[model samples]
Target: MKKEILNCEKARSICIVQTLAKLGHFPNRKSEKEAWFLSPLRSETQASFKVSLKLNRWYDHGAGIGGNVIDLVCLIKQCSIKEALHLLNDESIPFTTEAPVSYPDNSGIEILSVKKLQHPALLDYLKSRGIDYKIASRYCYEVNYTCKGKKYFAIGLQNRSGGYELRNKFYKNGSSPKDISLFKTNQTSLIICEGLFDLLSLLSYSPTLATIHDFLVLNSVAYIKRTTKLLTDYKAIYLYLDRDNAGRKATQYLLTQNPHCKDMSNLYEGFNDLNDWWLFQKQQSG
Candidate 1:
């Protein structure tokens, strides 16, 4: 195909909904402003990926990444930015051979119960993100909660202060006493991450990484300063923060404070975070 070379701004403005429809990925449900579909990225039953008709963007809640036509194509086709632009220019190509297949529980969510990881739905959510159930089960719990009296369940990562970082397809919420989680490896070397999924991605990538190094998962990059005291404990600190403005600032601040700290985020340069990188790798590998 003789692809038209389009710039990013122009490529992003392409009608995403129209493009997906042309690709045979019509949404399973629709509204005046938004549409939902089973993610064309992976095979699943229920729809979690959403397309904003007004904003002209797509967000896959399961994978926690979203963007315009160009970004969606990059993920769907597992291609580079330039390749995504080329594919975007060619509308005749329907990438998917098969058909692609949220929740309302608002403010003041309550934790009803916590149990061992066993929910089929939750497991499927993890699978969609390229995380192994066994690895997740080792550190997380199946937390049943309620919001506006509606019952729900999610994968919960507990912190040292007895709080949980709650995540489901529909929402990402944190329980009381939000704090950093530290996994002691009794080793002087440390691997620091920004979120639960990213930490899990490291373990999924190679369990040996954790075996040889301790891990610190900051609930938020705002808590980056909290690690100052702990920084001196490790001889080598490898940072795996998000590749965003705040994460960049945090990484820069940490690198300055702890001379031993190194930005490992460069390893996943194009990705927003480690889990996103891991998901891309897993998808490409398949």
Candidate 2:
């Protein structure tokens, strides 16, 4: 079979509805139209999933999964360029499935120009995402790209390799390594969270912790190997994984491997992560 190139617009149109329907944005004229079912992806109880044929959308409250037609196709078919187009063309599925024509993959693409760190458009996106560009600038830079004669810029983290860890207003790319900050404070206290946001939230809320506590942000749980040895050194390491399944699993796995470490998830039991807990506190205060 010949390789299939996708028409971008068609694929996008086809995917938007499916994603919207899955996200429960679909309009339901009647109670029956709000049909509910168990999530098809993960095993769970309760019919949190709903479909809105009238609005041509779907939503699953339990999983927090929502998107448009193109996103749904990407999730369902594990889309490649050709597959995305093919799925869009199939009328058996709801909504139009057409996408702009995609060019061949140039995997070994090289950098053309590096963008300015303080570009107004770039800074605006960072502000919207709750990231301070001043802080982000310490670790990331910007780069420019051209597609079909259009110019765009992206912020990127420098990797060990010369290539950048690229992220833009729309997307993020590359991998972030697990980073652990160790301090031997007399208080014998330590904290751990999944990402920088959570750590910053914790620091912002707990002024008392500034005295003698060390912290770590396991960039990816997969990098746990780099952290296992460091856990042994801390007198009371706090496992502050997210409240989601991945977070719970990491905490559980760490306890199994290093029983001496303390689990800090109890500090924010109801919420998903440290940042979530902060948001909760912010809401409660208001």
Candidate 3:
């Protein structure tokens, strides 16, 4: 007896955008030929991911990586290439099975709606951050909610617990049930970062890094210990944390734990963090 897997060609023929929906995802924007989404593998405020309906290609602008359906599954599920093939080959199975959100946090935040990312205010906010709406809308939502007797809205990045990590130009807060964000590739290399901006900045420079490497985004340095347990499984780990005391302490602690860990803060030396360095580069280039 022999096991079977989806041939590369078969997997390539499947509709990329439809697969995204099947995996509890949908595009934020779409046109005749293409659809845009926030990269599903990691949390993002911009729609940096795209799927070509006509060509059946997918790309993530922030990460700068793209491919067909097989590549999409491999990246989203953080599974191996072989695993993606087998998963895609099975039509009877639900796409990328996810457990129900356990103990979600509403925290007095009343969610009004979650919809395709659109709205001038949110788009402008993303632009101010040097992110494109075309990219941010993919994995993020234009979320409207009420809290403290006031109505407000922002870009929402859903957590594993079904709560949202909310952000905007003036407002920033998590709805509840905050947790770490992980981009698992089951790869030998891991890229660790302190917050969302730092992770996005790194991905903008090297899109293939996530595909080739793995990611453990603390979302806060509080999750540093969570990463120590993960490091034992990787062949190499890169730390892209901030240049402050907490970040430094976390980096030092990880270094003592794993010989393969490398601190990449020097890449953004003289700056607050990776995003600041990236923003400065953009200014200089202009």
Sort the predicted structures by lDDT, highest score first.
Answer: 1, 3, 2
Clashes of 1: 1
Instruction: Show model 1 residue runs off by greater than 4 Å.
Output: 1-107
Candidate rank order under TM-score: 1, 3, 2
Measured over all alpha carbons after superposition, the RMSD of each candidate to the real structure, in angstroms, is 12.0, 11.8, 20.0
Question: Would you estimate the TM-scores of all the predictions?
Answer: 0.63, 0.49, 0.58
lDDT of 3 by residue, 1-286 (tens): 5557668877789888778888978788889988989766545677878887889998664443457888777545545577788877777777744632222233446677999878888888776666645546644788988653457788887755566767776555556555667767579898988776676677765666757987777766665676667788999899898897768988998999899999999999999888789888878886
Question: What's the lDDT of the predicted structure labeled candidate 2?
Answer: 0.56
- Runs of candidate 2 with Cα error greater than 4 angstroms are 1-117, 131-169, 175-190, 206-211, 283-286
Q: Candidate 2's error at 173, in angstroms?
A: 2.3
Give the clashing residue pairs of candidate 1, or none. Answer: 38-101
User: What TM-score should be assigned to candidate 2?
Assistant: 0.49
Instruction: Give stretches of model 3 more than 4 Å off.
Output: 1-106, 133-139
